[model samples]
Target chain A: MATIKEVAELAGVTPTTVSNVLRDRGRVGTATRERVLNAVAAKGYRPNLNARALVERRAPTLALMLGCITNPFYPEFTLQTNNAARRHGRFLLVCNTDYEPDGGSGFLAEVAGSLSDGVLVANTGSLQVDELKSIQATGTPVVISVWEFPDVDPGIPCVAFDSHKAGYIATDHLLDLGHSRIGALVGSEKNGIHGGRYKGFCDALRARKVKHLKTDARFGTDSYQGGFDAALDLLTSTPDLTAIFVSNDLPALGALNAAASLGFNVPEDLSIVGITNIELTSQSRPALTTVAIPTAEMAEKSVDLLIKLASNDPDAPAMVRTADPVLIKRASTAAPKSRATK
Target chain B: MATIKEVAELAGVTPTTVSNVLRDRGRVGTATRERVLNAVAAKGYRPNLNARALVERRAPTLALMLGCITNPFYPEFTLQTNNAARRHGRFLLVCNTDYEPDGGSGFLAEVAGSLSDGVLVANTGSLQVDELKSIQATGTPVVISVWEFPDVDPGIPCVAFDSHKAGYIATDHLLDLGHSRIGALVGSEKNGIHGGRYKGFCDALRARKVKHLKTDARFGTDSYQGGFDAALDLLTSTPDLTAIFVSNDLPALGALNAAASLGFNVPEDLSIVGITNIELTSQSRPALTTVAIPTAEMAEKSVDLLIKLASNDPDAPAMVRTADPVLIKRASTAAPKSRATK
Candidate 1:
């Protein structure tokens, strides 16, 4: 906790000279710089970042507002953003909006442009565009880190990935495996947050001229239990289906387990695929076949853009489109038994 | 981005009066306070928390240094701590040390006493006690949020849960089911971070007069793949074991899948028990029967203790012991087939 004054006093130099030596700025004699360095090392002088932030008119951290921390995907996104921020010599201030009563409006009001230089909103589905814009109006840069739909701009700065492509890849993989009877498990309403992915599923089926009946799809909450119950109900009602396409990974893992519980040998009796190849997809029993969304790329790009916007860089894009989702074929999908028998 | 001076000028008051009215301090007439408030709302002035922190010499955030954010346990722990910090009107600055080249020594040196008011170290195993003490010596409060061993103090302010009891409860659950032929899977070295839990398992076995063979145990990394590989090996070698006690939930989950892969029906062929009932344990098929550690209680206590220490409260205890670990009986355990037939 040695102050700059103490170090300056010990080094027999002015406080500004000590600051110059520490920040590697301004001209100081080599001997004077050495003296300041020795004094800093001897006294264990660490510069106060908050004090420096005030002097520079820049906060030392970026605030990342996430809806739910325990949702599995957010942790991965947060970790990537945290590392990306650190690489830029900044710390990440994580604001979990799920715990906030007003869903983080209070937090945004308090910290925007004051305690934090920029804000990154991860769960854009739960946040309003006007709220983010209002914070942006206060001159704190706000970037939507995970906009699921790239085709429709959210009217705020965002990093978007092709959710429709992710769904298409997952469904097309099952179709390529020669499965005509495929069920869809949407993690939200038909036109909710996961609408793009659901649309892709329908498009992929239509492209192949496969008839997707009304009873072939079930919509529910976007969670493990949601996937489990929906899959259980779907499979029980439509027992002849050869494959299932789930909108999200959490529920897909649930479908995987639910398939096991119902004595349906995965990829043999029934094929299953999910979008967003989260870490759990690979670790599951059958090693889920999922379409890998560019989670890390989107996270890093979002942080980079937020930092640029905060610095008033003219080159910062309003919407950054990341790499397309790719198919990650694993043990969960295979050719239908009818084809195998032929 | 409106300044306090602008609000003061519009309200027809001195800057000091405006400040006092805004902070609700000093004597001010009701009419004057109303004028100041109206002007503040009209001007959209938000206080710069960094400047206020500088004036008060108190940072507005607490730093939580965790090893891995993606780990199921850490997210749960981080969420609880985030919620607790929010309740105190302080933001949570999460530092993921696993990505740090110096393993967070540099992050600690930079933010400990400057940017964050206090540091809460969640992953205590990899961090050195001397490093934590050094930060504490610099006038920043450092609290170990998840000290596994309560009997042995880590020489820093900490919140500890009974890791030993957590192990005991998990092992005792298996013993109660008449599974004498039990194997052990330690997620760390036999005498490493999970030693307390491993010891509890041994004690539980000894209490029941059940002999535990050295060959019936395996030690490995505390991850899903680690548990999967180790359990696959353990079950292959010690096929007679009717039950297994895993030191941690993540590894236990791996073991559950490993057993399933090996064609063993959980609770029927092999009753498995794990410590720390993470969210995944309940979501897994048939669910995992594990000991539930007081994760939230420990997190809240740690944040409270750190806040108290930051305020230099004399009543702050050196070490706080949280509520004992309890057994959460799920679907993962049952009586051995031998005992059931008898």
Candidate 2:
């Protein structure tokens, strides 16, 4: 409740000296600085941040917009980004878009209008290219995470992982186990990542010279329900399938549940592999065998890139930080039975 | 970006009229408003949000601060709160505290200076009652979620669930299943919710005339690894235990995995029940039989309460929203084997 004038008077310093102390800049003697700090602490004087932002044209805060909060994947990214930001003494303002295209745009617009020094857009599958471009033009440096825009040039720094490679690695692991008949429980292909994963799955099958069954492909929601429904459909349609590759860990978990409900033993009747290798994947019934994407590493690197961009460094290139998709073979995957192959 | 004057001149309206149209306020003619809107759209005029906020002395943004972004529980809460905020056409800013006592206070101070219209403080176990009161004194309406202050009343609103009842329900379910030797895998007692749940667990055992063994208690992180370690310790120390009630689903999941790795059959050997039946719980190997807390509903209602409190509504009481914790009986829990009793 104490005012800046009161602190200045108590410290025997001018209001300008008090302001300089708060900003941690300008020429001031060490004794004077100590006296100003002590007086400010004694009086409990809080700086007026809005007025300061208006004068300085900087908020010292960054905005991180995520597609969905319930997905657990975004949180992994946020956790790392937040820590990195804090290390640089910056604040991160997070917002969840809920995977709505209009909502993503709306949130981006709001972030542009706020006191954020920069914006970190992550997994905004629903946002159109034009909307992204317009937001980028708002003078706020943006770092896009996980997903990439084809039209976005090197000017827009992007932090992405190889989703296509992730899909291939997971499927290849299952196939290497001598499981020939494989089904893919994928998310909606309307988004780029899901589409990329689907493409990779097809490419892997074609490369292996296996009979690629169109009926084996099942599309569902981006959630567990989607995975559950897709698994049910795939199982009912292709009863001979020996392995299944899901697009993400969430759906993979759903598949695990659906498989259990259907009285099918995992790895024994049907092998399952997923991407993202979320925390729950390890804790699940049969620990999920997944393609581990380095979410935290990606987040940390993206913040560094964005910080460089915000500092007006032109040398900072659009970084695509892709981690090697390591196959975490667990109890969920195994070799196909000779009797089932025939 | 075109200035307000340019748009106003082109639209044949005064700058004040243009400002009113931009703010969606004042009694302006429909035709004039349309013309201003068209000119603004054609010229690509963006109202300087910083300037507007400076004039209004309000940021027109709400901030939600959590313990950590990696915790999926916070994200789940954020998703629902965001949906509600979006419906009301308000922007949300999220910040993560990382559950550090000093760091949490620093984040709160930073948020307090950010000029947010309101704040929703979901403290991790790190925050004390006095720190929360100090934050509330900033005149910014705060809605405390997950944790409750014991003594301080800063005229701020709060939204909390009955964690004790949740604990009681989970423990009672295991007891009702004829499991006498129950081990409790709880979070640190320093955490408000964990303490409440622990008390409830003790009270349930007392009501059932069962001897609650203090040696069966273990304290550690609120993660899967923590649960795994705790379960391992408890199992070794209390070999006669037939059931375990975990504080949260994440740790409960770890316990499940530890049980499997230790060659113990769930239900037949060791029955388990967890709180916060998160999405991963139901999707786990045996499908976790736990208590389901209405996280999304609580998030929505919390934001609604905060909004009301911010509007200076005297009708808003110091409310605590209690959602019924439903017993989701799954394969994880069953009657103990006759051999265990013998």
Q: Which stretches of candidate 2 lie over 4 Å from their true place?
A: A2-36, A99-101, A148-156, A202-211, A319-323, A339-342, B6-40, B99-101, B148-156, B190-192, B219-221, B314-316, B337-342
Best by DockQ: 1
In the range A1-342, model 2's lDDT, one tens digit per residue, is 788999999999999999998887799999999999999889877887777766877676788887777777878777888888888767777777764457677677767764677888886566665676777786777888665323334345787677777887887787778878898887876344587777767778778887667787777546888898888877877788888989888889888888878888997888999988887787677888998987887888778888888888989877766566677877888888864566
| lDDT, residue B72, model 2 | 66
| CA deviation > 4 Å runs, candidate 1 | A8-38, B8-38
TM-scores for all candidates: the values are 0.95, 0.87
- Measured with C-alpha atoms, the lDDT of residue B64 in candidate 2 is 82
Give the TM-score of chain B in candidate 1: 0.95
Best prediction by TM-score: 1
For every model shown, the clashing-pair count is 0, 1
